[model samples]
Target: MSEQNQDKHQQRQQKVKQKVDERIAAAQKEQGIFQVITGNGKGKSTSGFGTVARAVGHGMKAAVCQFIKGTWECGERNLLEKAGVEFVIMNTGFTWETQNKESDTVAAQVTWQEAKRMLKDESINLVMLDEITYMITYGYIDLDDVLEAVSSRPAMQSVIITGRGAHRKLTDLADTVSEVRNVKHAFDAGIKAQKGFDY
Candidate 1:
């Protein structure tokens, strides 16, 4: 081949390689393994549920294990269940709301165990651990266990951990972390938590 033609060929190959590199970088940015939604505000679970919806929309399998606030009828649970999202509710109301620490702790532990199983399932593309911070804060489950699961899930699997008072360690392990700050809520304005809106 002529030297000039050889140079042109090399340039074309370089351009193609650059394009491939760019595409791979974009794909990696879109893929993530760990996420946390936390703060004193509401919508932590709602944010997690939104991810669940997105995952389900893409036909990805998902699992949700809600720790506290499980007994109440949740609209997300109802809708997602019908859509083939596996859900395991702890069935223990809020510890403060229930005024039963022991029972709540036991329930949280049980739910965490189930979540751990779901996290290890290679078939599950996404796992949402709703209200998981309470389990860590109350010592119902070891923070190390949570960290290990977040770190060791399938390379492409994503996990969403949601609750207020998220520990610093959890945040450190998260690839994406968001805090939902509550500026104001209708409940503070004498509006009850409506069935569909709040519950």
Candidate 2:
């Protein structure tokens, strides 16, 4: 690169750094955040679990409440459980596969009980509610109940709710909301879900 081009690049980077430093200096709030990962794409739960793992890596207590994922093995769960993260799985399989509304509702309610307990416990630094939006959409769990529990959680407790089609109120209440858009997926190409990649 020419010297003039290099000087221009350095000036641009200095301005960018100044803006970033100013923003960092202006922000003073310190509290756990409520994050929602929702969309019609893959990796929503994967992203949530990544945050749980990050918290665990920091020696923070974490818990997971899996709503729609039944008794299937989960790679993230297998690893996080060994790291001392608590898990409360519904173990009812997917709703379409179960095909039993009454039983599914009972299981969802029972699982929610554990979730509520974890949410109330101040010791747990992070809580991941995996695929829970489906329960609210299916009316197996009440949205207001979930909202109440989340809103009333300890001030320093972070929460991650992951699933497709998140409710508006949940998004509104979240400090951070990320929607993953699906441009394409291998599953649509008749490619089966690969182990350690899809799961």
TM for every model, in the order presented, reads: 0.84, 0.98
Whole-model lDDT values for every prediction: 0.89, 0.95
Tell me the tens digit of each residue's lDDT in model 2 across 154-187. Answer: 9999999999999999999999999999999999
Top-scoring candidate (TM-score): 2
The collision pairs in model 2 are: 70-93
| Local accuracy of candidate 1 as per-residue lDDT tens digits, 54-169 | 99999999999998878899999999999999999999777878787788778888888889899889999999999989889988899998999888888888999999999999
lDDT for 127 (candidate 1): 95
lDDT of 1 at 173: 84
